[model samples]
Target: MTFEIAFVLLSLLGMVIALILDKMRPGMVLFSVVVLFLCAGILTPKEMLEGFSNKGMITVAMLFLVSEGVRQSGALGQVIKKLLPEGKTTVFKAQFRMLPSIAFISAFLNNTPVVVIFAPIIKRWAQSVHLPATKFLIPLSYVTILGGICTLIGTSTNLVVHGMILEAGYEGFTMFELGKVGIFIAIAGIIYLFLFSKKLLPDARPDTAVPDEEVEDGEKLHRVEAVLGARFPGINKTLADFNFQRHYGAEVKEIKTRNGQRFVTNLNQIVLREGDTLVVMADDTFIPTWGESSVFMMLANGKDTEPVPGKKKRWFALILLILMIVGATVGELPVTKEMFPNIKLDMFFFVCVTTIIMAWTKIFPARKYTKYISWDILITIACAFAISKAMVNSGVADGVAHYIIGLSHNYGPHVLLAILFVITNLFTELITNNAAAALAFPLALALSQQLGVDPTPFFVVICMAASASFSTPIGYQTNLIVQGIGNYKFMDFVRIGLPLNIITFLISVFLIPLIWPF
Candidate 1:
């Protein structure tokens, strides 16, 4: 093989290693690889940094703000309270009523916030009805993922791919174009979850426990605990060397030394001895994975948990979210576009206003709610665009596209569409959803160019397939959110999600060509 090919292959291998290890955040891993490529003269500095400026990156950042605003408004709380039937109800009926609405709402908003809003509500409702939450939570996340495919702004992954396609010199997707196939895939997914999820999903629910004594207000320190295990990448590292705060959303609060020195405050230079304790303050979603790696012991009580918003804040947050959606939809129209040319009514504008309004209102307390946004996710998506640009500029995407076209030499567009769907879906399972789309978008454009056909069908397929992350919780944020809240084992997701994944894949592969023929 040529040296360039060998270099690309090696760089890609390193990326895979970083993904599996997950010691550093995914965005940092991608950035590190990009820098390495630039130093090796494989990619230009501009190419390495281009993703930060991509429209997709900006849109994603704005969407986070918008989601935050809605979450702060308390809109979702009201929806949950109304949908969650009181008194005794069968698991099937309760799920049918709630899951579809959640899915539909997710099709318009971010799925992570949707899951966050619903997880506890579902849990409480399940308790009230005497049913295991396990029966509904996995399906809840799965449906949101499926529904995210229906609109451009629904997920950052879709917008990132859209920007990459635009950069590739093809026409980008319209707001509703993906809906043609997305709707069908969502329906198929919902049907699969409704009919089969109950039988296949596990019944792992956390046992109720007595409440612990409250910490003294003055004596309490801002702290979090994380258990480390064999799977952790930083097993032998020290606190001084480990850049936890820079990478993950954490700050080291205190450490218990191996010599049983409890609450060691001056641990900056201390080595992380095995079986040592680490007190940290960060988002709880990330704590569980630390235990899988044997990095430390477990979190202190209340380490990986967030309190549900009170009644007043919940109502305010929910109303603001609805208004933002209505405003964005109205603002995007041709009439509004013409009237508000200078105002520029796009995802960024909508999210900014919504965030500002929510923050000003103190609906969920500006300081606390600000921390809820996943900044790492935004950075990962931004870096994904740059990696995609590198892939296209390096001619790697074209080479892969050529191989695909060559394989289906005599086949029709239907076969070509199926190939694209499978490729995008498989890539998403392995990497970040946005990264997968970024990598796939260029190939989709190249294939359409080679075939002398319209690119919309190919683009549509990539968007839907990228968001159809049903096989693994690790693949999508929503999956992870529900996994912890539901107390689900890994295999439970596989049992229910594997079938939904297949159903969405089949529907996309067959229906996309028919709806938007090449």
Candidate 2:
């Protein structure tokens, strides 16, 4: 095998293993692989570095800041609080009441913040109304994801694919262009959840859900999970001996071992191992104190409950978000170029202006702006661009495309689109969605080029497949967020999300060809 081909295969294998094992973050793993390609001379420095300055990747970053500003504004939370049904309700009634509005918000705004703002509120609402919180949590995440697929700025993955299309010298998606198919998928998805979710999803959440532990006086406990690392000093020590509570200001709720059995009954006598996972009850102070500590490498579900923003600030933030969305959507029309050629009235222009305004206005904690942006994701995306370039440079994309084509040679582009959807969806389930999109883009593009068709359809399928990450918690961040709070088992995702995944796959394969064509 050629050195380039060997390197690419090895890099891909390593990524698959890394993402599956989850020993390292997907962004770090992808970046590390790109660095290897750079060292082997498989790719030039410029090619490897293209992702750093990628318009899509940077746009994602700016959106993060914008989302943080919105989150801090507390406007989304208040809106959701108002929209939730009053008094007790049936599962279908609750879903019918909220999913459409949730989807609308998700279609225009970032899904992560929407979930973050809404999940707890929904959970509390469910509890007060004598409903199962679990029924709503997963649905909340899924609806946001469904909504995100509708607009360009709705999800980072959409923006990443949009960025790639522009770089390939094609006309990128306008703000509402994706909504053409996306709206249909969103409608299909919400309808699917509404009709079948009660039967499909689990109605699980502890009837006596533990309250947050007091860090100081009068602070309630919040249940959280922390995975142990080698850096933890009390590896073999019992919690009682280690004084875990005294040291961390948290109480152990349960101890799940590497062997998979949880010891919620007698955790004090159990010896902590490097890989043992601890379910603890902590207060807000725990995050700032031990969140970065090496002792627990993966800490989750310690959400802070801040008071909502004042009416004036909330209105200002809401107005800013509306302006950002309106400006971007309106600018995509023919009138923009003829009337405002001098102005760069694209999503990029509006996002930049909105980000700056939010920053100057201190909508979020200005000093902690860096904390909101997932630098690892940005790094992974930047590195993914290089990885895609490497695949193209090494002829890996064409080779893979040809091999698949040989098997499906008798089949038309629809079959190819199905296979592409399945492949991208698999990659997404194994790795990050952005990483999956980056890897799939080149192959999808090559497949279209070889078939003598427009690459637009392939691009649409890639977007559809990459974001249809419903099979596993690892497939999407939103899944993990809900998994932690909902007390979901691995099978919970498989049972519920698998069908959603299949539904999306079907929708993409059937609609992309009809809409964009081969």
Candidate 3:
């Protein structure tokens, strides 16, 4: 290997190690790698920073605002209520009823917020009806992931790949292009969950249902459920360190962690994490006080949350979201493309328009817009583009592609496709999905060129594999959200999600080339 290629490979190995160890935020780790590339002359200054101005990255930022608008409008919360059955139901029946629709809804919104909003409601409903919350929570997280793969704007990873495609001078994916293959995987995966999840998933009994009338010292105490967000000041700190009761005026009664365990006895000593769920005892003001706060992703009282936004505002937010999706879809059609040859009326344009409208109309708090977007993810994506460029620039991607192709050339591209899928999926399970796609994109691009085949199949596999992160809770943020709420163990995810992961893998390998062609 040339010194440049050797440097890029070693740097990438270090990046992966840093990401896996989580020694720093993913964006910073990636940004550090890009800077190193720039210094080594592997990437020009413009090439290193081009991702900051890339259309795909900006679209992701806008979608975060759009998602926040819908989340604030209380529309998703209402939808979850309507989906759950009114009475006691079997695990299969409950999953069958909500999983598909949840997947569909998730296709249009960010998966994390979708899970954040729905998890508490579903958990409470399952307990009320005598079903295990554990049965439905993991499925809820999995379906959102399934749904995210259905659209270009479904997940940040799709937009990241789409950005890379545009930068490479190829026609980027349409809003519904991924849906062609994604729908099948989603349907099949959901069916797999419906069939096996009931047996494979553990059934952890929820804590005793909280009573509405817990009179203590002649004062009424209400049970408030709060799912900690990244912004929570006390993350990685004990309750005593943060003075949870003194600051929030709510006494934490039980703490559930992402490892599928709970700490009720040593609440004061337990260290807090982003996805931990806390059942606290407080007065009526608990929900209203922290309802819109950034510290908690979701806060609910008993089985319900505070009143949603005004009906008119809720309807307007929903309509705006629908219009954005339809507009982006139609813009990508050949007829529309021909009419607007000079101006690309695409997702980026519609999202920009929708975000401004939502801000002006106050769907989400406009002034606090900065808080809605995950800057870390955007940084990670922009840096991802830079890092992918470095790989291509250094010839490392081509060298690795040739090595991989040599191993499987006799077996044909099908084997190559499967191999690429396994690598990307494993990385996603170990790190973040966007980071995985970033690491894999250049190799996939080079492999197609080396084999004299269209890169479309390779591109499609990257999208699918990077998103099929079901084997572990840490792979996807949605899984972590549900882990604590459901009280699921690490092995619980392995048991059920491993099978679903395999199902998605088989579908991607056998089905993608047929649709996009190699």
lDDT winner: 3
Measured over all alpha carbons after superposition, the RMSD of each candidate to the real structure, in angstroms, is 7.3, 4.1, 2.3
Better of 2 and 3 by lDDT: 3
lDDT of 1 by residue, 381-401 (tens): 767766666666667777777
* Candidate 3: segments with Cα more than 4 A from true spot: 208-221, 238-242, 265-271
Residue range with the least summed lDDT across 10 consecutive positions in model 2 = 298-307
- Sorted on lDDT, highest at the top, how do the candidates line up? 3, 2, 1
- The collision pairs in model 3 are 260-488
Over the stretch 1-518, how does candidate 3's per-residue lDDT look in tens digits? 79999899999999999888666668889999999999999999999889999999999999999998998888898888999999867888888889999999999999988988898888878878988888898889899999999999999999999999988888889898999899999999999888888899887765646565555577788877778876788887899889999889988888888666777787788988766889888888788788777788777675566358778878999999999999999998899999999988999999999999999988888889998888889999999999999999999999999999888879988899999999999999998999999989999999999999999889989999999999888788888877766777889999998888889999999999899888
What lDDT tens digits, residue by residue, belong to model 2 across residues 1-518? 57788789888888879877766666778988898898889888888888888888888899988887877787887888888889867989989989999999888777776876687777778878988888888888888888888888888888989988988889999998788888888899889889887887787657234565565677677887776754677877898889888888888888766533467787789987655667788877776677545566456663435347798888898899999999998988898878998987899999999999999998977777877787778888888888888888888999999999999999888999999989989999887898899889999999999999999989988888888887776677677666655666677778888988888988878887888867
Q: Return the top candidate by TM-score.
A: 3
The CA root-mean-square deviation of candidate 1, after full C-alpha superposition on the true structure, stands at 7.3
User: Global lDDT of each model?
Assistant: 0.70, 0.81, 0.88
- After TM-score superposition, what is the CA distance of residue 129 in candidate 2 from its true location, in Å? 1.1
